[model samples]
Target: MSPTATTPPVLTSVQIPCCVCGTMILPNAANQCPTCLAQEFNLTERLQRGPAGQKHIVIHQCRNCRRFARTPTRYEFAEHESPELLSICLKHIPALNQHDLQLVDASWIWTEPHCMRLKVRLTVRTELLSVVVQQRVMVELHVQFQMCPECNRDFTNRTWHALVQVRQVRNDSKKGLAALEMALAKNKTIRQHVLKVDTKKNGFDFYFLSNTHAQTFTNFLQRVAAMRIQRTTKMVSADNHSNTANMKTTFMAQMVPLCRDDLVLIHRKAAGSKLAGSLAIVTKVSSTIQFVGASPKRTHVSDSMMELSADQYYKTEKHYQMLQAGHRLVRFVVLDVELCDEQAPSGQLYEGPHSGVEKYALADVTVARESDFGVNDEMFACVTHLGHWIAAGDVVLGYDLVNSVGTDDWEMQEQLHGGFTLPDVVLVKKAPRNKETAAVGVDEQEGQKRMTKKRERRKRYKEGRKQKELEETAGRMGFFDDINEEQVDEEGEDVDADFEAELANDPELAAELLNLERDLAQLDDGDVVAEGEDNQLVEEDNQDS
Candidate 1:
């Protein structure tokens, strides 16, 4: 026997259930066992259940799944733990997730299973906060209008527009806007009203929630502004005329309305051509009230223009002054306005704080109708006067003012020197008794400002002076001004010693006192002498006997 061939020691085979398959796989097989490789588990279940008794580990289970293919111990779980710990443990699992979580954090994912759809709401409170919403720098804006902001009791406008800059949280997102609206609806201060919502490019978004008299808000003003369509850019000057020191900013717009027939007039002018983009509201003082009628001649322009809503169009000072006039809000049906053929420019009431014509001056308006209107740059037809004093109907195209755009408010008397340029058809109402608005002199405003400033400065100065005087007086009184302290005992002793020294230095008094002392000494001596004399006398008597 050729030395019996040693049999290779057979290795014990340990089978491991494939994580991917339900079948046991041999350790030495080059390929995964087909049965073990085909195993599957419910993913959602893997994220549901947490680790046993571990606070950080939550095993997650699928709603419809129970086990991993045929394996009994395989399932999904979601764990709850701190983000710091999860980062250390889940360092190897490749994953990407947008966590919708409230109290639960990412670290929880490391504890056995971390796959739970979480929804959460958080509320945060802070002290000494930044008050982010209130720090905005804003401008106060005014636009020429034929209606009043107060006519409908704009308490909201007044309280919101006061000098204070308010805090606001604005929602630019669609979902946030709806949520904000719902939240505002619950507020007692907010009234219930439905506003239309439109979402489109070149489309305006208008929605707002207002607080009438609130300020120092953490976040709320932007919600209120959204209700209005005007997202305006505003700039402020120094304190305006009002002592209140409010800044002023103005915008351009046209608020007049137009009729169906006017569209035909515009249509005829374009002669069946594209009419939408060609027409623009001309802001020139002379161009503002000029109208184009169906006949295309000197025709009076009515308040009803194509622009449905009131608009502010910057114009010559005259036009601004005119638009600044007192306006009375009148409601008329669309058809009734057409029947009237013309409407009066709402007269501006420059009263109270606005006692004078603003910086804008009166314009040199011509007298004319639609036919007399002149075209400037072939764009807008210029009409001299529709309702102004000249009463003549004339049309002149594009005329530049002395320095600026012409305003329609008041005409300089000099423009009348050339006589009427257009045929006269309508008469401007004769100057009413108080036609000349009481011109509040500019000096009055300036003087008032000076006086107010002077008075304030004087008050502050007086207060400072009084405080300084009191402080000086108090200082003069020395330490402990109220209660006086006793003089030091040493000082009293010195005073007494000085008084005694002065008494001793008195020459006459000292001499008298010295003589008294000499007498007392002689008395003692007298007694002794008296005794001696008696003895001598007695001896003498003895001798004589």
Candidate 2:
């Protein structure tokens, strides 16, 4: 019976029903067919983000600086929405396991400035479905234009916790404004801390969001200018329930009146201090005024060690113009310099500010006005006016001296004792002779008028002056003699004058003629060796060879 039954029973493949749809399916197929599973499975069932409702993706942004609130930090307007927008969209969409959903694409379309349409394409994978599902979703977001807390406070204009009033004692608003701008540019943190800047006639007002920031700007000013500060506070608001009050603080900063290069006299109140009673020249203006006193005796006035005031203990005696503005520097050649131990004579002393106190030696230099002749021109200037030592061959600037007003002398003597005299000429900066003169022209017509007067004066002098004056003028114009044919002496015969004129026109031939004249003069002076002596030397040399 077993042998007869050995024929294998007919085995048939049975169709298995899908778990999800109860439809016949192959064994190798997933739990459900693609179509049936797609119909039954929900793509958003596992979405961690809840369905759209009262709770939505809310974005808080600043209206002024355009910063968005991004949980931990406020993102700048320049930041491109990346994981931020993705995380935000996922947070609002109805989803359970966010990992199961993949955002394929997301775009924003501005319906209005404050409103945007957010379109997102999501690829969703479900555990029960064989095929991936893609869903396109859209939402309209109305960006509320309500100001952020900082913006609201900024717009209120009264929200500043601290105010700084910078007052310049000299009422120099330009300098104050320039200094403020420079300070802000130099320090990034200080600029950032500043909330508002208001310009005034003699000072400036700075408003800061925080008291510490206001103090920071004040400290910056203190470090850069000599100033004093006073602080005050007032209660602006109070909360009865919380027992809290808002206090508005103000910082008043007073800047010094003394600026760089100003000469100041110390009063009796300042005499007892290290910087008191001595005359000083301001060299720098910063958190404190810096000065260099008379050399070898009093060198430096320290800011940290002394308290200096513009009005009470100090007096600004005089202000001198810089080398560029006061005088047009002329070309001057130093012909000679005489160094002596004796003090400079009264007639040769520097006359402008510090005169007899600072001693300088005598020097005789030749000065040539820019419109005059070459470096060989002769005009004398003693070294006392220069206030500095000079040596031969050094080209110095010839600055016209300012006349001292005698009426101001009595007042000046009170500040500085001893004889003080203004100079006839001041030797300013030393420079090369060939440099082009920088003519500061205020008006073309005014300059033309001055030139016309100068030409008229020169014409009168040329037509009316005596022979001695003519010789002096001729000597001064030595550089032009080689270039101008008419510059030859008119007293010469016609043939000589003609020859001289031709030579002047031909510079190379004129140079050769001058060389020949020099050789002839050497011969007349017996500078040329005798022919017999030359012959004897030549014979001796020939015998030695």
Candidate 3:
């Protein structure tokens, strides 16, 4: 029957003759065409991903013994049209993105009655261009939370999830990377799913996207260059850093905080699951805690919500921010700090009061700062913050202090947690000896000398401030006082401000004035030294004569 003119053309299956067998067969095989069953070319549509945003490409394969073996086709003694031709060749293929193709389908063609032919097409779903630009890289953050010192036994119930914008995505080998980057500058959080990542690829360099179009990738590159620094530095004693011990498995991801609570359910292999112990809520978050306290020592555990929600007594305090869509999580709990005393000099460490009652102090307050790392004197400059100077060898309360590193960095971290910076007195030890040393006497005389020098430095600081003020006034008034006319002062003037103003205008005389000032200062210093030398020499000559 004749079809209507408006009807769409249907794609019918193609059939071919078996070149060698000279037999008729179905047009389609499992993944190949029947005629080419003996010799078929297979093009596979694999779901394997490359770098997430790089439009996925479908691999083409020729059907033969080797290529056909890979497919689940029933055709066994298949002969190929071209045995010598590479089955999986990148050529003889069309360039298409992941979404351009359809699902795995087979067809066939032939030449002589002796041979058959097979063709396979792989398919892919369409993708939204705007959505891909929305998110390119996922940003996951984890923080340990805590409550105010006044709050007793408090804990963060859950981690605060933020879809921080990772500015790397807008690039993705595109022509409009700059335009895309400029658009995303105002927005930070991105939808987690929007940023597709290929875990197989070690790194992703895509900037996150937001509602206000995507930002230019160039801007994100600039931001990454500025603020990133080593978040944590692990330093061992001078002797241990190089040769420190190694273990079987080093880094690991532990369970989230909720695992600590007894409210969690534990399942058995045979019987049904039951409600177990509670996690230790060492830290606080108004109502919910990161973990429930189950034991004396704090450990971590995490199971899927589907598995644990079966026994549902625990509270879920979802804040307004939690409603936003995101798959990333950041979990942590700030702990109640305590001072502990132990047996060794480096003993009595400040362990956490995690579940019930435990103690932990700045490593300094309890034991010593392990000095085996590369903490040398030249690398760190020691300056007294509040008129206190700590010596190298004095074991103040018992902890070891590094050369001039007055206190531990962790000690000051407490200040960020609503605590204040540590005082000079917090230094537990004089720090002259290692964990093996006995109480050695400190030189009382040296301590007194240190106090004397502090007074001198204070006096010097006062003089320096006064000098700076006078020089500022001299420059602003456009007049020079002899006291403020020291050669050093002139050289120290803001060159950028005066250089062009003076030199640009009086380019000729500026050089002379500078030279004359420098010469005068040199002569004055020389004359003073010569006069002293002459006096000493004259006295010596006279005494000899």
Candidate 4:
């Protein structure tokens, strides 16, 4: 027996059954078969669900600026695929074993205001066989909206942290309020912080959501209004957790009673001080009150030494003294203007609150008010404040002092030389009055209507004639309305010359002119024969004579 072929028994490879499912599998396969492993690991069915049964997210969103509430001072605008949305969506996700389950991919499918959808791919591993399989799960997210604190406070009820009282002690509260409103319009930040504005008789009361905003507003007034600010706080609540006291703050901004162009009388005692007493006109008031002389050539300027308080300065009833007041304004025609030949006076001459007016060269002006109406009521005016604002032929408003007394010798001299007292009138503004229109009546209206109709007819006729003339001229110049009307060849006719060139170069035009000449000649022949017969009769009668 050929030494019995020592070949080993035929070795055969056989498929092995999976440990879990007992199904045939490759020898190198994992412990479980593919179908069994796939059946064991199902992410779609085992995906973590929300504690509320549905993937829902609750967030506070501002309806006004469209922001989500996260912190007391911070807000975010949520979008369709924002990380904030993803974080909020998965906040309640169930935990998974990292060794067996892993997230492969996740994405938002569709997002709307009320609802959203998400797709997640999870790789799940079978614990027994270590077989890896992938499963995709769809998640539905429901969004519920709640108004943010800001929106709630803005829309329904308001809780303010600060109150601001802006008071202008001036009698003209409307003007002050108008200026404040204008300031609000120019600054957007101030407008945003202003929660409410209530108009009071003296000024405005403002409510602010934050104390910082109120402080900012008060600081702004310090720059614009020469105001005094006072701050006070009241405890609103105590927090045991923070061991802090919550307080509501109030800001009061008291603006000076005086304004630009206001005339104030400083006490004689305070004159040498900042008040610059006598009759001081307010040139500018901001942080400090600026004063200048009331003279025509107001050349001197000074600042208040001390803060002007309401009690320190007395209010004057001479509202008409300031040109900006408008009520005391009187229209004057410049009759004459003459430069003073004398040397400019020194500040010592004017004495109290001279405002350096003595250094300015003065001019004597002769004027008559329009109200006098050529009644020979002439007044002398020394324009110190607005000297250059007037000239000959200028009908301007002049400050009148007919009802007052002179303060200085310069004013007395003006009264003596100008035939009246100091500032009998000073030019302020130019006002021109037009001829008054007559009242319309039924008969006059009818006549006016007829006249208007006639005028319109004439105008139409004139316009039509001009248009026709233009069209005729265009036609005569061989300028046709349309190029299609041009009958000439590609080489157009030479229009530089007139009749001679046409007859010589254009045979058709020459033929037409020849026919016209022949017709005229035939008609002239009969007329000539009749004239010759009449001439022969006349000659025979002349020979008999």
Every model's TM-score: 0.19, 0.41, 0.15, 0.50
Worst 10-residue lDDT window for candidate 3 reads 320-329
Off by over 4 Å in 3: 1-85, 88-545
Query: After superposition, which runs of candidate 4 have C-alpha atoms over 4 Å from their true positions?
Result: 1-68, 71-75, 80-84, 87-106, 109-144, 186-189, 268-275, 284-289, 296-326, 338-369, 373-378, 381-383, 404-545
Best by lDDT: 4
Candidate 3, residues 196-266, lDDT tens digits: the string is: 21111111222122312123332343232211111112332345658763222111111122311112212
Q: Is candidate 2 or candidate 3 better by lDDT?
A: 2
Score each candidate by Cα lDDT. 0.27, 0.49, 0.27, 0.51
lDDT per residue (tens digit) for residues 218-331 in model 2 = 878777777778899999989999999999999988777655434444432434444444344444566655544321121111321244443332343233111212113344
Summing lDDT over every window of 10 consecutive residues in candidate 1, give the lowest-scoring window.
328-337
Residues 1-545 of candidate 1: C-alpha lDDT, one tens digit per residue? 57877889988878876545545765533334543222221222222223342223222233433221111233333233434323322321111121321122232212233233322111212111121111111111111112222222243443222122211121111222222333343342432221212222212222322322222121232332222112233443455566444333211111222111111112112222221212222221111233222111233333222321112221211221121110111111110001112343333322335555221112223322222235322122223222232222222112122112232213422222233222111111122222132111122244456446545654656555444433322222121123222422231232122223222322233344355446544754787799899999999999999
- Candidate 1 colliding pairs, count: 77
TM-score leader: 4
Overall local distance difference test of candidate 3: 0.27
